[model samples]
Target: MGYYAKELEALLRAGRFRRPIMADPEKLDMASNDYLGLAYKRKLLRRAFERVAAYPWHAPKSSLFLGGYHPIHRDFEEALKEANGFAAATLFGSGFLANLGLIEALVRRGDTLFIDESYHASGMVATKLVRGEVVLFAHNDPRDLLEKLADHPTKGRRILAVEGVYSMEGDRLKREFFEIAEWFDMVMVVDEAHSNGVLGPNLLGVFDHYGITPAPRHIKMGTLGKAYGSYGAYVMGSEETIAFLNNRAKSQIYATAPSLLDVALAHEGFDYVAKKRKKLRKKIAKLQKCGVSCGYPEPEGLIVPVPMPGIEEAVACREALAREGFEVGAIRPPTVARPMLRVILRTPLEARHYRELFAHISEWRDGV
Candidate 1:
């Protein structure tokens, strides 16, 4: 505990925590997941705000499982499912809970859980909790999963787990991964937390872009916090799986449903993305021109992950950029392999901001 405290203090001294600042409406901000620049748009804000402002305050008097599931929840679920081509979707409070709930619904004690070695920590914990015999394949390496599957005990069942886009490093899922999932008849769970509103020509996620429909063997978990710029997550699957999760998953059954206002905002956010994804993609492309190394520079969507070596180097670069009136995000693991810097490229940050950021990087003292 002492050692952990000392390490946290080290991070604090470097300004890495850096106040996780709220967006200044007047400032040019890139620190948020508002990739489409929709979160701040007054038009959409007014629409959602109006709905929330009108919500009957008396609704909160009811218990979550009773009559507390608001009309907006159903509306958001329908719209989200329609937008993403899912047969059905169930909302959860956040990505971590969604991932955990999905796993618990799918895996049992006798099952074999094979996960991407670097998959999100939440998915890993979910798989572990059920005491499923676990096998891990190298990141994006489907052949390794196939080989492991050959020997794993089918006395139970198998689930293949991986992220659609690795959140930390900005890497993408290799197409071949789905083939392994298909071949093994393994339940494939794809967490599109980072990729949902960013991938494909339609922002329909990688699976939909590839023309693969997620079936019983395929599950999609998407978060509202990232590209959606809102506050929750949803799992997409067949009606049966959703029903099972709602009944048996501890995270879902125990937690109060999310706020009506949050669901309203989520609906507005997704609607905005559906209409303006092309514009967002173009802006992301222009940003790639200036940064020396942006993870997936041409980006498969709205996220631009800029990598900087050394923890101190990343920290200093972030502070320097922040002081310059730019709000770029600095990410150090437990998110990435080592420490890397990230910049969320909102549509508000035009080509000129990218230029300034690149210029700042050139002489920036990367404190090591």
Candidate 2:
């Protein structure tokens, strides 16, 4: 315990130690990634349960390739493919697994993987396991990416990975990235964990928002846990790409299949988002307006990051907000370079709650 004790002490001294706490449901939530507020929808849950109850097996009970792929999974995958305009789709246990499988399988020897510096940690970790050269471009900078691409030439495939919405920064992927990928003929991987069901006129994702048709080289990965309010992930691409992943993606081939109930619930969530898109957009707009009125920049999606001077100030702000019955995230290093209060402008939170939350944040900023 001596070595572990020293590491724990160091974390405490730097004010970066963390521990999960049970959520206080009594408080107004502004912290979670449930952007659509579908997690708390009783009707949705009941419907999902009804659908799953009809199935003989509650869980997949094995890897997707080995007698585990159920009709529920197939149904959801088909729906996702149709919605996102992809020729094929596949499911994974989570976004982390999806990234691991995608990168590990797609990036072979001689391939080059170009990624956004601010991309999710899962994808960054996946790069370490791949048998390809990994190069990171400046966050959301197309010029940097173009320059980097020219500097690093590969005899094999050039893969580009980026997030639709940067989780902590809450900024949308630059539109120029799509053009750059097309020009370079790179296989583009768009992780839409935060942007799916939030951005785009159809509430599908960035491609839908930009009105770009899915090409054979385009791979879109999205988590069902965030906006969909379920706990799994799915990847969509061309038929050949999906077939290749099915054969080579170790995570999908070895890990237990994604939960049947969660997939069912996510299917319902997808339907709900499609049916109530106009209403959901209004809720998002209302929160964005409130954020601007409170002196914050216009949020590209649901996340609104309130910058903090330091770790202590960030923690103090979180505690102060909690005292006022509002729960928000006090994000600190090494998740971010600096500390900040990560606010999720969830649809479930009322307009009055947004006003109060923004007022509190404004006061905190003023004092800081």
Candidate 3:
């Protein structure tokens, strides 16, 4: 216990302590996951919330297996399932819980789990709880994943996990990843937290980005928080897959279901995104013109990672930018493999905002 305490102290001393900050209306906000900016639109959000205003505050306080489950949840699940072409769908409290519950239930002691090296922290945590063989492949590299599969060559239950749109790097998955998983007869689990409302004709996710139909063997976990600007997540898969998780996924079975208001907001948010996608894309295109260039892969979504090279330099750049009234994401080790500025774009941002951001990055890069 003392050893862990000391380690935490060291992290704090090194400016790596994790702390939360309440959202400030006056701040030039850029550090949020509100890709679509619906959360910031008061009138829109209020109107959406009004649809469920009749529901009581403490309506959904019980776990799904208990009294928490509601007809609204079932209706939302069915709607999302039909829209996304899944055999069945189940909702959870959040993206983290969705990934934790689904992944833990799928990968057991006798199974093999292959995850992307750059997978989200929540998914990584879920992997730790699995009593199975866990292998990490190079980020977004299908060839390396193929090599790993060849090395393991498991005929038993196997899972290949990836993110549809990488949260930190903003990279998108290619069709090749799906092909590789299918070739090996492995279950493909895609966490589309960042990509859910940013991709597809109707924001259906990665399959829309790639212009392909969803494979039956694919298990998709998507969040309502990021682009959807709501407070829950959902897992879509075959009826059998969903049924198994409903019975076995500990997080979902034990955790309280989302409130009726939250579910209502998510349903409305989905419709909002679908209606405003074209306009949102225009805003994204404008924001993409901001900031300094990086060597990372081109973004397939709204996240724009501006590289700062090292921890000290990244911290300095973030601070300097903050002083200019822009609250950009100051990313560092542990959350990512290396230090870089995580700049998430929103549909409400203007060209002037990006121009200021670009100016700051130029100043930092020039060391002036």
Output the number of the TM-score-best candidate: 2
lDDT of model number 1: 0.74
lDDT of 2 by residue, 1-368 (tens): 78599999999999999999668999998999999889999899999999889988788888888899999999999999998889999999999999999998999999999999999998888899999899999999999999999999999999999999999999999899999999989999999999999999989878988998999989999999999999999999999999999999998999999999999999999999999999988888887777776678888988899889999999999999999999999999999998999999988887678778989988877888
Candidate 1 lDDT for residue 272: 81
Off by over 4 Å in 1: 1-27, 53-55, 58-64, 288-297, 365-368
The alpha-carbon lDDT assigned to residue 230 of candidate 3 equals 77
Ranking by lDDT: 2, 3, 1
- State every prediction's TM-score relative to the real structure: 0.87, 0.98, 0.92
Two-way lDDT contest, 2 vs 3, winner: 2
What's the CA error at residue 76 for candidate 3, in Å? 1.8
Give Cα-based local distance difference scores for all models. 0.74, 0.92, 0.81
| Model 2 clashing residue pairs (backbone) | none
Worst 10 residues of 2 by lDDT: 287-296
Residues 91-193 of candidate 3 have per-residue lDDT tens digits of 9988889888988899977889999999888888999899888999999999998889889866568899999999998888877988887878888899988
Candidates 1 and 2 compared: the better one by TM-score is: 2
Backbone clash total for model 2 is 0
**Clash list (residue pairs), candidate 3:** none
Candidate 1 deviation (Cα RMSD): 3.3
- Count of backbone collisions within predicted model 3: 0
lDDT score for candidate 3 against the true structure: 0.81
